[model samples]
Target: MADRRLAIEAWESLFRAQHEVFEVLSNDFVGTDLSQAEYDVLLTVTRSPAMTARLRDVTANMLISQPSVSRLVDRMVGRGLVTKCNDPDDGRGALVTATDLGVRAFRAIGAAHGKRIAEQMSRLDDDELLALRALTEKLRAGVDVDEA
Candidate 1:
């Protein structure tokens, strides 16, 4: 019982910390060309091979619902930040590729955002940051099994 209670408390702390950090980081996007959601999508898209990713891959990386991601992608397409095309390898799947405009925008925002993230995280010492990263990855791996 004590163990379970401790686990619950730890989880709550983790959740609150994530929320707080998210709120702080979200401020960085206020006047930018991308919303947090759009930046998230672009981040994943940009990280993928050749700066293109499958729609399902993007949805998987995002915290938003599949429908929400679809809608967001449509909005981004309309803005000319990304282009969607039928995946040649998978007839049922769509591929999202960052346009030159999207790449430029992402690069501009990413530089500042990266610095902001580093600054925010600087509160943690290097050792603590390494431990936190390992712990979070472990937690994610546990959850990912269920997700898969």
Candidate 2:
């Protein structure tokens, strides 16, 4: 096996770096209509077909718990950012669709957030970024992500 100390050190450094970079990127939500969680919701929803995504899928993409996601989606629904309805294919599942307002908000925040992310990641050159992506994908390869 790899050296235990080196493994721990590598894990710690990766965790801390992710935390710090996320903290910096989260500032893009300040003074905006969407909270980071809401933005995350829109991030998943807007990328799906017809600007709609399954509720389970949203929960999957989110860092928060399933109940919390349900509540957040409710709030978004109340705010007219998204509409929720039963998933036709699955009786127990819900489908979320972004409203025109939601799309606008997501696009506005995404443009700024994308720029900020690029600026923060500029510390790494193209080759390093590609390597980082490959490393992360490899790390995630063992994780079992559920689509249902």
Candidate number with greatest lDDT: 2
* Candidate 2 residue-wise lDDT, 16-118, digit = tens: 9999999999899999999999999999999999999999999989998899999999999999999999999999999999999999999999988999999
By TM-score, the best candidate is: 2
lDDT of candidates 1 onward, in order? 0.93, 0.96
- The reply for model 2, stretches above 4 Å from the true place, is 144-148
Which 10-residue window in model 1 sums to the lowest lDDT?
Answer: 139-148
Q: Tell me each candidate's RMSD, in Å, in order.
A: 1.9, 2.3
Give the count of colliding residue pairs in each prediction.
Answer: 0, 0
lDDT, residue 109, candidate 2:
93
Error of 2 at 24 (Å): 0.8
Which sections of candidate 1 miss by over 4 Å? 144-148
